[model samples]
Target chain A: MVSKTEETQLNRLENQVDNGGGGAWEYLCLVRKLKVRRSEKVLKHGLSILNDPKKRSALGPEEWTLYEQVAIAAMDCQCLDVAKDCIKVLQKKFPESKRVGRLEGMLLEAKGSWAEAEKAYSSLLEDNPLDQVIQKRRVAMAKAQGNISGAIECLNKYLEIFMADHDAWRELAEIYVSLQMYKQAAFCYEELILSQPTVPLYHLAYADVLYTLGGLENLQTAKKYYASTIDLTGGKNTRALLGICLCTSAIAQLSKGRNKEDKESPELQSLAATALEKDYKQRASDKLGLLTSALRSLKI
Target chain B: MGLGFIIGVFGVLILSHAAYSTIQYRGLLKIMEEEFSGPPMNVVLELLLGFVFCIWAALTVPGKFLSIHPDSEENRIVSLSANLDFMIFNHRAKAFPLEIDMKLKH
Candidate 1:
């Protein structure tokens, strides 16, 4: 529906905003709208506003929130000098603010001073133990220092207090996968699936973990979950199609010497194989010949 | 008969050398166990060095003098012809050269 000229004009406007040609407040709002606080454009516009004395005075007391936002954005963009200037201004205005203290800790984090950042975050937590941002930052500091187990511990504690945080669950799952603890990752995915059962990605991830575990029972469960993923995505997922093929083959291998009644039927294997071949032929463009030949070699 | 005798003698010589090295290794192990009263690491290092020497001797001594080479030009030509025969026997004739007869179907 969007014409080419309109798209070009939109891109030009975005570029202008990105280069700090847009007003500071508009730029901040735009970056916030995009949920991209760490962008270089945010940092540049934030600095321009805070540097000009006239523009600085024009921002009334209520707009002091902009200073904190700008400082954090600057820290995210690795502009420590601009961040420090903003921090000094905020600290002078409100010397006893705990939120300002959190920003100070984040500044230390930006400086690669992990221990000092930890100390700063700990003192802030002691003053106000229920601060979620401080808790998350502590977890982030542990992660940045490559203490994955420590990060996991902190995240578990945070999740105990805030059990519904999907982002925290996803992060814990990722850490478990990095450690090759697939069972624990599956548990995390299970929680995510329980909370949001309709999400295709959670089902896909859980199926992948079960497939990696690879027993007859786990493979059957993985196949069911992968089927659900395929159904949820309307059969567009190549990986789910491949997973179905693999699980069928693995089940066939496992049940080969078992009782005849326990074996997955030949008809089911043939159906999965044919479906996979059709989907691969239809979807796989660059590796069409290779994938088709590979499926053919599977002998299903 | 002379070539067979020479090959038999070389084989016996290699086998005897291998057996002697093995017996010497066992004797060294027994000696270390009974006489050496140093750290365990020294015994381990000695055993490791013995193993390395055994493998090195096995590789270098017997194979170097016993390999039969077919390095004449006639042998090389025979090998090349065999490979050419395999290619010709297995090759399938194409209907046309791939670069020609380009077709577009919609």
Candidate 2:
């Protein structure tokens, strides 16, 4: 999801910090903003600033946020000691802070103390039942501890309160997909598509689920969604093109000779195939044979 | 990144330098007891060169303008409001108890 400019800026900042160019804080903030998984880089560069007292103070009030950032990145990196020390600094500075208490719960989670983490999250939830972050954390904890059903239940309950959360819906849809529950996954994808009709990812995912469900009506609907995905992505997504091909061929086979004019629109398959060929020709002409062979196997 | 960004900044610096040169020229004219005319020719040329550099850099920075377009699908607001604070990377779904699947199926 990161833009090219932002990605290049992140690389430049990382190099600048690595060479002691003194922008460790800026690099860490960009990393956070992008939500990138650069735990090692963040931990290394962040500790350099944290270990230096002068550099830490130079950030002023932002230093506390930097400490929290480093703490989370450290936890991701499995550096419990550094995370503990950072949390201790935060706790000492802001005693009775619910934010710091959340950090404590996350730390317990990182240490694999499931019961303690649950207890901590429960207490936090007790203080504020509408603590959405804490509730999500509880679900994530359940998922992390291999309690898939519990995670699903918790996510359902969480969605009851936060129905507008597309991310949670996506997470639930993904969990259902992994469990081979295409119907449930399709429900979640429908919810997501209803909320965000412009998002091609949701459309593509819904099409995938619908195609996997596999029936006359579902395959037709899946092909429609796949075409919508292609329109949304400007015909750049090979997966959606392939989906259109697959759905077309499947629908054709299922409805073979059933009617004189079944409205199958045989031209749709050739159009999809042409688009696929054009894409392959422009990008990887060397592997065009593989693509043609694969398409031939699909009978489209 | 360094090339385009540096060229842009250099153009900005040059434009500022041109402004400064104009001011210096005015001061020199006042000291010489002459009329306060326009900037020197070299400063005008420098301004044009800087403007061209800025335009070039603007058109070809780290990426193309379509990526930043408001209507492009790639620029869509997909996960801007994602509640990632609760995100956990270490998923153990594969290790989930098989009995639970049997229970869920029914």
Candidate 3:
């Protein structure tokens, strides 16, 4: 049913494949199209060309491009196993290339080789120590494997490499907080605040850790850090919240003093009074209610 | 006599500043205790000043007492203006939240 000209075009394409100049990807594409079109002759020709061992051996840069092409074609054809095998071959051939490793890692991840992907990412990180993408990918891979500790450890390692990376610090802090590792989280938050003295939430985070640690001395530091947050905010709306936190933390620290039955110093009482008066209206209703309860219990 | 007087004046000024810090710290402590219900102002003030005084004394004490020669490296690191590059290296291991708190907007 096909025209002579169409048949000749097919023959020429097959002959092109036979010459081994077009690379693996080119042949894969032709074969895939022929399979879709149900052209048996073209498909047979493509398969024959691709399976040639001599063609595989001659793969240089052009061949690597061909390998990627063939792998992608295999993926497109839903032959994921074939694609993976092709990538493995490429990995062996180009062991030193980051691109090859990354591609292999992606393929492994696609195939659900979570642990292998993590190892590949780890190896990549050794070469590109501050590669944020790899760092994130490594965390994701660890977490996917249900290795929460592993995920945390990987990020901690990343933090060591890129210590000033606030995002890494923040991520570590969040993870610690989630695990109820308050002391460690607080230390991380402190580093964050010291690194970026302007961020108010880092102060809040530090204060949260102090509260969780449950001590008067920690409470005092929390109050001071909150004040620093407020001062840094310079009358921003957030400053009002920070100021309230500062007051509340101060109040908590003050309550600890009552354990000694020491009469409240007048100046200390005045400052608390002033803070209470200033922040009362602005304080969140829930927080204010909690504050009232604390005040009653402490008899402040 | 003139040189001695100048030296005496310098010493007095340093002592006066230290005394002022002490008094201020004590006042803050009293405020903290009465207002927040905490420790004596003097104790709080003393604790706060302890580190400051140590650092101050360490830096200002003449070469005779545990002398540390001033180094350019320390000076370069603590420039008056905020140096972004230096800050990056100094705080490399520390991560601060990039989410700027809306409440902190100046």
Candidate 4:
């Protein structure tokens, strides 16, 4: 029932493989097509092409394409057991392959076997310590298990590998915030703000952390963060809320500084810093209040 | 009472839907491999069937009774409607509410 053109195309694909033109991806695609067509002949041919040691030598890398193909085929056939077996075989053979390892993790995770999957991912890390996907999954599993320390460790490990990953940094900051590790969380948020200066939420979160930590010395930085956040968000009230925080921090710092210095206090520095912080806070609060009133009016 | 009943119905559906979809998703994967040429259509059909299965599962299985938990930011315990609650928790939850606490973080 196949059209001549289709047959010719399949033949061309075979020729491409024969001539060393087919890469790993091309072979995988052929195997997938074989599965789609339910052509065992084609599937076998595709496998042979993938398994050919000569092809592997030419292709430069032989990872988990064949294993993935078999797993997909097995899953398509409703052979969960076979799919499971294929996964095991793939895991054993291509232990370092990302796709195979991830699929194995997903299958275990799907079965509600979180502990086993976590263990597997941990073992996987022993081999590929810098695998971001494995690290992220480990964090996710740890978080799911409510192991905050474990999740933090996993995320930290991931951060070590991918220092510039803003999302990872933000997530780590969020986790630290939730854990009430205010100082650590503040630093993370600050780093994120430094990298993605345009994002208002990072500043807001950082300011919140500074307020929670209850240090007035950080008020100046908090104010800058809140101001920047507000500007980026079109001067929204989120900025204002954060601004109040900055005000409080400044007051706390000035009062503490005054008491610490006693008669020797730098009165000029204290007054200038406090006045600057108070002004910023008041402006933010007023704008935020206006937004709140507008929101209330809209609701009504 | 209406809220409780609606909640009960909703709980049942959520459980059934998850189970049914899992089964159908597995089934569709097999079908896709067996007949690869028209897999897109089959994939769509499987998704549609998955939706239907979810609805059916919601209607039949009393999800509230099972110790089912979803790991998400919002930890929603299985709060069943009064009617479904009667059927599911009457025996086990005589002294306490049939609530499954999902610990999102340790």
TM-score of each: 0.57, 0.72, 0.39, 0.40
> What is every candidate's C-alpha DockQ against the true complex, given to 2 decimals?
0.00, 0.06, 0.01, 0.01
Q: What is the interface RMSD of candidate 2, in Å?
A: 13.0
The regions of model 1 sitting more than 4 angstroms off are A1-70, A89-95, A259-284, B1-106
Best candidate according to DockQ = 2
TM-scores of chain B alone in all candidate structures, in the order given? 0.30, 0.58, 0.30, 0.28
Ranking by lDDT: 2, 1, 3, 4
lDDT of 1 by residue, A1-300 (tens): 122233344456567776756655665654454343234555566556666667767877735777777776666556566678778888888998998898898889877787898898888888889887788777777777778899999899999999887767877887899899999999999998998676677788899999999899999999999888767665656677788878887887788778757554556556665676677666776667887677666654
Candidate 3 residues lying further than 4 Å off, grouped into runs, are: A1-116, A119-132, A235-299, B1-106
Best by lDDT: 2
Top TM-score prediction, candidate number? 2
Docking class of 3: incorrect
> Over the stretch A132-250, how does candidate 4's per-residue lDDT look in tens digits?
76777667667756778988987887788788977677778878888889889988987887896645566677877775665455765565555555454444333444365435445
- On TM-score, the stronger of 2 and 3 is 2
Say what the interface RMSD of candidate 3 is.
Answer: 29.3
Off by over 4 Å in 2: A1-26, A53-55, B1-83, B89-106
CAPRI-style grade of the A/B interface in model 1:
incorrect
Q: Each model's interface RMSD (Å)?
A: 33.3, 13.0, 29.3, 23.0
Quality of candidate 1 docking, DockQ: 0.00
lDDT of 4 at B68: 25
lDDT of 3 by residue, A1-300 (tens): 122233454457667766764543454554443322322232233334446666655554555665655554343333455556667777788878887776666566645667787788888988887777666667756655667799899888877778887766777787789899999899899888889765555776687677667666676566566555445443332433444444554565567546755332335433554455456647665577666565455443
